[model samples]
Target: MRRIAVLLPLLAIGVLAGCGGSSSSTAKPVVKVSGAFGQPPTIKIPAEKAGGSLTVKTLIHGTGPVLQRTDAFVGNYAIYIWSGTSHRLAQSSFTAHRPTLFAGQLLPGLETALIGQKMGSRVLAVIPPKDGFGTSGNPQAGVKPTDTLVFVVDMMKDFKANASATGTAESNGGKGLPTVTAVNGAAPTIKMPTSKPPATLVTRTLIKGSGPAVTKGQMVVAQYVGAIWSTGKVFDASWNRHQPFNFTIGATPTQVIAGWDKGLLGQTVGSRVMLVVPPADGYGKSGSPQAGIKGTDTLVFVVDVLGAFST
Candidate 1:
């Protein structure tokens, strides 16, 4: 794990503050960042130390949605610790081949730099101690209380908690599967029948999306509801939490259940899919007792594919 990942946790939430000092007399720091959007940037720190305040510079302007305090976004970013005459690279989501989710509260300087920026823009932020990890610094990340931090962020995609599938409905022909009632921008309702659940896995597309088909090894954002077929009781739902689930599809060792890996592949973004998962592809014979699922019970799920990003 990257050192910053250990300290920041990516989706941290906290107070929001604007870039730069509160006083007009404060001068903007001279930090140079040069690179193409979507690639790692080359940063050159000034020989002189920066002012005792946050500084923000937009390296590239994007035309996408303007981000808000409560909005969420995917970004390819790199962090460097600037120690006056020298700097050290701390972390880079671009190098890891995975974009990061920036939402809720972040490092005050980071949030300030990103909040008003447009999606697809590249932003650079120089964060002083007060706007970063505070006076305690992040010793584990080699950051001293006196050191300033630099961030280069490439905003890739923006999304909201209520994001859902958008596409034309496809008829299922009443194939004896569970029925699903989905409304755009709202949580879906699913009803199961008393008939015996399918013994094998069943993948059905309830809505055909216009976006690209999902590929293996891509970061996927989705909203879903899972229920036991036998009892028709809801066991889990991302909608209830008001946050979409993010996972790397087909990642080694797996980031989700086997059924999800099998069912989501090839599904297009914005499509709503239904998967009837048998034990072998689900929680297996052990089942998920905490979720009210039995050893032999089958699982039914309706999932909305919100977004997909290549690693």
Candidate 2:
């Protein structure tokens, strides 16, 4: 068995709070596996006669309350790549505490597994190629497209509605612009007027792309550029790097500040947006060490929509 380093320290501990529940001595039987790529998993449970095959597996069991769509969750999990003869390409662990069913937070298979699970439940899910990293595979993940992925997940706490109630009226503070138009069952389109320059020079559309419409839980990929609205000075941009930063949207309140969330919500694929964020919305009080963004700086971004995934 090839053992990759399991970086547990990188895992989010706070997310695993309610996962340490009592374990049931009785073991659930693992029977024949039936299913093809691009299809849901199937497991036969002997405990209940009416039990149908489970699309995913709950390896570690928890004894906490069940979860609902309105609830949010925090968790720690390990992902491993599985070869035919028990060899694993790589493994890593991380923490995620966010609205469980929200789009753009998790992989397709893991998101599907989490939908009906409750707090304190431990899940061990076997993900096939199509459901995991697709054809190109995750080179950094060390798993090939042909590899099967296994995830051991521990659901910590499920916070009920209004759990982390931000007193503000909108989800984030009422900072972001209101929806100008809604994309109704069509590919998102941006109509930038050629004749006139946008009212603001610095603008961005943080998330973009087409797959499934982004909700709140799944991960989002985007391209971004930052500049000053006044002088058009380019401050920061991901265009040169040619790689989008991968962050699970809404998973960590601290990963991104309030302004970003407010800016991104309800944005559809292929949307282009401009933001003129005040110092309070950009960098408040303390500027970033590396970026040289000042405490009093009002930032602007030009964001391009790339793609979204919901599993």
Candidate 3:
């Protein structure tokens, strides 16, 4: 969960956004499912069918805001491969996770299931092969391209965009860890450290925010640039991606390295902070070659805290 993750086909709608939703309307249901969201639902998989269109059925109605096509959404969802070994459960976000989903980031069939649905609503959707992974299946999740993907999505919250952090320029040399520099409101850059790595996590606030305080379990949205202390070369950066990434500070699953969980906790949103992580708090002795990191290497990061939300 540290780097950009490869989501299973059913959970891989992370690129952009799209539109569509399950409604109480003229569309007919081809598959029937029982039970509810929050608890595993009983699904009666439909007989194999040729390529077709998408369908939807609402098991629980909600009274929250109607999800719009352009809005960003976060929620818990479950996916089952239809017409396979007795409705195989493929993926789920119901356990210790909160995924950030937005328009254009969703598959066509999934877009339809999300729109028009209100927060707290649970939806059952049937996606034909054309609307799903198509002919080339997701081998990681065992979709064979011909597989039909079924989803039971739990609409959660629509996160409002957070204003980026703002502050005056300060001398970069006073910090005990790494020196940080920022352009005219651009992402901050880290000047690598020449000193031996700290034995524990080190946190220093370069800029402060007035927004809400970040708690331990709340999902944190931040833009960050990470580099190896030994070389001071960048390995990963959300700034380069032009988007912020988030993690549960100290949560069990999908939580980031220990340095982040400890460094950013209690910091207010819209703040800018730096983390100097020892090997123990970072990628550990094995290190991450993918990031050009070594076992004994330390890690440095300049993180811009953007937003925090609980899904």
Candidate 4:
């Protein structure tokens, strides 16, 4: 989970009631949140004692799908701890210009606040110590045992584990590129070209998605198959695991290989893109022996962008 800038350790939470209503039967604080959906919010915390129970308020209702605890989602958040008159900021995916992947990896309180909520909504939750770090306050984030945690979240996108790409198919312009065979929403098989591989990185879109264009510092969920160009052997395939792959698209040293960072940028969500990666953008001189990749082997990947989420 890489922490992903959270108030507590990255983890999952349990499910709650249905969406479209605030939680009752709990004594909550008076926290004000003002912001548009999908944008950074201005949260005003009361300079008073903590709340007695978990409290959830939906600032802006969304028209998207209702989220479930089993589903994976992406959203931007701002966290703070309230103790007496001192309110301090802990972490914010909004400030980082990136969204966190809420794949059941989050604090229990925060997770409970999100489940059953609709995508594209703005939620404010005030969690007491019971649902937060409990009796042992999180010293790493400077929280006291009695301190209450406040979270402002902007829900962006949600997807099931088996979600696939949906877009308009386009001609692959098959000139010097490998042939891809995709059927029945399964993994696409790649047949290498007889000619030599390209010396540099090459990206071709087999499907042009109408969704938002993928940008840097965004979490991208996709289904992909990676093969060595020369032997045409599949080194990796997300479809085989029956789960989509997710990573933060960024510079080479960050979440994924350099080839993915460069080739996937600006690609629209739901597009099936083919990437021809040279050695420099791959594992470099020290190839991945475990994956049977050599230093000079050019790699080929067929990627289906399922979704993209940003701050």
Q: Best lDDT goes to which candidate?
A: 1
Global fold similarity of model 4 (TM-score): 0.76
For every candidate in turn, the CA RMSD to the true structure comes to 4.2, 14.7, 5.7, 5.2
Q: How are the candidates ranked when ordered by TM-score, highest leading?
A: 1, 4, 3, 2
Candidate 2 per-residue C-alpha lDDT over 1-311 given as tens digits, one digit per residue, 9 for 90 to 100: 00122223223111221111121122233323343322232433233221111237665456777766444454545555555545432333332322121222345555566767866676666555555555655655465556655556667655443221111121111133322222322222222222323333233443343433456755445455565433445566644443343344554434454455566656665445556666666666785536666665555554444444442
Of 1 and 2, which scores higher on TM-score? 1
Decreasing lDDT order of the candidates: 1, 4, 3, 2
The C-alpha TM-scores of every prediction are 0.85, 0.40, 0.66, 0.76
Return the lDDT, model 1, position 225: 89
Residue 8 displacement (Å), model 3: 6.2
The segments of candidate 1 whose C-alpha lies over 4 angstroms from its true place after superposition are 1-29, 47-50, 83-85, 139-147, 172-174
For each candidate, the alpha-carbon lDDT, in order, equals 0.79, 0.45, 0.68, 0.76
Off by over 4 Å in 3: 1-26, 30-51, 56-73, 84-91, 95-105, 111-125, 139-146, 152-173, 183-185, 192-199, 252-255, 309-311
**Residue 69 lDDT in model 3?**
65
Q: Write the residue-wise lDDT of candidate 3 on 16-114 in tens digits.
A: 233332322223335666776556566666555523557777789988888876655566676777654345777767653665545235766777777
State model 1's lDDT.
Answer: 0.79
| CA displacement after TM-score superposition, residue 7 of candidate 2 (Å) | 9.9
Model 1 weakest lDDT span, ten residues long: 1-10
